[model samples]
Target: MTAPVSRRSGGRAARKAIREAPLTDDVRPIRPGMEGGRYKPLSQEQVEQIHEAALKALETIGLADAPDSGVAYLTGAGAAQGDDGRIRFPRSVVEDALAKACKKITLHGRDPKNDLELWGSRVHYGTAGAAVHMVDVNGREYRDSTVQDLHDAARICDQLDNIHFVQRPMVCRDIADNREMDLNTIYACCSGTTKHIGTSFTEPDYVPPALEMLHMIAGGEEAWRARPFVSNSNCFVVPPMKFATEACQVMENCIEGGMPVLLLSAGMAGATTPSTIAGAIVQATAECLAGLVYVNAVKPGHPAIFGTWPFGLDLRSGAMTGGSGEQALLSAGCAQMHKHYGLPGGAVGGITDAKLPDMQAGWEAMCSNVMAGLAGLNMVYESAGMHASLLGFCHESLILGDDLIGHAMRCVRGIEVNDVTLALDQIAEVCMGGPGHYLGTDQTLLRMQSDYVYPSLGNRMSPKEWSENDKPDLIENTIARKERILSERSAARFDPLLDAEIRRKFNIHLPA
Candidate 1:
């Protein structure tokens, strides 16, 4: 179903005349940060049980490999360290931290209008992945993703109405040096889009230099701190109860640098986590809750996203199947738990195991994207462009996924039932006095732009019309759309002088 397209007249003419418009400053019927907790995969009792189980796990099994500073902070905040070096949190500590956790956070964009207020079950979809290979549409093959590719992807996302934020989707395989890669990733994303960007750091030290670049972009350290446009996607924990030592340190630095932290716990079900969906949620919740306590211990009420991102594994082949129904349920269940705690949280969705953006990719992407929004996930990560279980990123697929997410957000918006929406008067007038059909109604025209969302790349033609139009393929259309967007659109969102200064100071590989 498409968003309500404006009609010039009736039937075919209206359909044909529905032009694909540019992204405007006007608010859409379905927009970013819409509340969406309509679907509940887990019951209240089930949520309570999972919460209890997670608390029990933290109290009993505990977590291992806490760095010395982490040990100090956690212990000082009511965590106990055993002789075996496992740091265990008492239930009170966990509860205290949960109470202290920031419930509402504004992930600011350099442009103030793009800021995302993450609170409750407000839904937002965006790009995110760590794909090593880029899906070359012209060549129909995978190639090393470069910094330029990342920048281009960001530029594409800036024009996509459905994509709310641009996270680092693919790694820069061109940059071998880890520090250079980290810094360039930040620069490319910032220079490409004004939307809030999400990126990862190699180590705690890499953050300071990256912050310097961010400071330059924001004009000063104070301005950057006041409206930090980028967040650290820190995977602070290894699955099954252990801290990633370096990642935890990196999280600390990000918290200190006035950057928001995504306390991510990505455990693959049936492998790193339990096979059952509830068990996986329990483990992920426990890990991220522990992360919450760690963050609170460092600084109370710090803005940290409760990222419980657990993927599904095809047990038969031991391969990651991000597109599976189980993965969708897992994400929905995790979102439920996040809501139970009243914390701003994130989950993965719209990932595809398909090698290409075919019918299989469409079904897979739509299924999870719809489910994730309905479940009210605050940040729907990897909601576009990921393919082959996230080994590759496709620009064409990303563009198509925007249309898919547009429909999904429409689902999240659901139906509005009110006095005007009841429309009994209109129905009476149409049936009794008016011409048999409501085709040329004033209400229809008035509500057209406000009530509906139209896809730029989606085809709405009849079979004969489609044949007459030369049977345009969706992929080809998406490819043309991508080319048009990249060629016609501005790749550089930053000022030319600022970009030049950035290039002059840093070893920036992306062309100006």
Candidate 2:
């Protein structure tokens, strides 16, 4: 009996060792494109009501200030243009556009492995925004963001398992010209990560040059078209039923250039959009639906993301409250609208009104991120590292957000209930005096890796253990991890010759 017990203990130790070992991408407990939509903020009837309101808004209110090309595109697609120059979509026209719009899209990465399948409740989280400042948490100061900052952010994002894509998160304040800034933004983000990138063009002409750079990186126009790794985060609307004319033109160029477009409608609640949450959803939905019509009209079946990003406002101070519970509901509600239309969608989440990565930032970030994932947002943009109501980006917080998003994704993965997961046989064996506990059981050993996610920076030790270890500061530890990652050579950098060619072609501001 003693010999049997010793052998059993040895088996348990071996299993523990295996479980503690690093896992490959295939076996990691949480990954990109995990299914969500488990949390529905709106009922079926409510969803339909919002849809009807949006359609009604489009037909009645319509949108103003479309560029001439956009006007041609919409008018040609059965929409009517008013004397005031607003494009009004008849119900049938909007429905037709919806029917023709691509339901699923693959935002490819330079490396095929990072491609994101956007359909149904499949969720992917990543960085987004054009923050002007970089948060120096240790110094408690904010400074202008530079091209190097953008590149470093992408490099950090490439290593993080939970951040699924790299959207241009900060403006390159180092570059004065808008064209050069836009060009450098593309070059910096693409050079640091092979993950699907998202960027914006300052002008229609900028699109051609940016696409030329992308073509050079992709080896040719055909290759770039085959796997256009970057997407355009085009804010096509000026909110309250108006179009951003220049942005619309930029969107047209992007469509012609073979890039996916995120039709962003960012109306602030109580400001640009209606104050009521439901009303805000209606306005944003209406705007994005109009964008859908525009995209389909320009070229039927163009891949477009229904980006309905309505922000929350503090009625008292009249400031944007990105981390508020109202913001979470707004994002989740928009996600449900996306599902109702059966379209690929993106929404904002994990943004912190807090200025730093403190206790407030943690709760603020977690609340919306978990809710967004649970609500099945296809692309949860700004899901990490945003601060000061989206004015600042932080490297330390970005690293910490990787751990935060990992936990949120596990929640999104939810509980798996099957015969095997029920574990009736294992339970019976344990109850029948077979070790009296299941920790050392074969089922326990087999499921450990698949059933759990472990955080890299999060401390889970007991108080005594923590004290023994000198009570490691979370921020300090995160800084150390960030340093270590930056210290290593990035695998995502372009080849030497390719890098030289790109430098020769453009006034690349980033240091080699």
Q: Which model scores highest in lDDT?
A: 2
Worst 10 residues of 2 by lDDT: 1-10
lDDT at residue 16 of model 2 (Cα atoms): 54
Cα lDDT tens digits for candidate 1, 253-356: 98999999999999999999999999999999999999999999999999999999999999999999999999999999999999999999999999999988
Superposing every Cα of model 2 onto the true structure, what RMSD results? Answer: 2.4
Highest TM-score against the true fold, candidate:
2
Residue 146 lDDT, candidate 1, scale 0-100:
94
lDDT of 2 by residue, 1-512 (tens): 55456775588578658857878877788989999999999999999999999999999889999998988989999899988788999999999999999999999999999999999999999999899999998899999999999999999999998999999999999999999999999999998999999999999999999999999999999999999999999999998999999999999999999999999999999999999999999999999999999999888999999999999999999999999999999999999999999999999999999999999999999999999999999999999999999999999999999999999999999998999999899889988878788775778767778889878899987899799999999999999999998998778889999999999999999998
Model 1 pairs whose backbones collide: 3-453, 4-452
lDDT of every model, 2 decimals: 0.91, 0.94
Q: Lowest lDDT 10-mer window, candidate 1?
A: 15-24
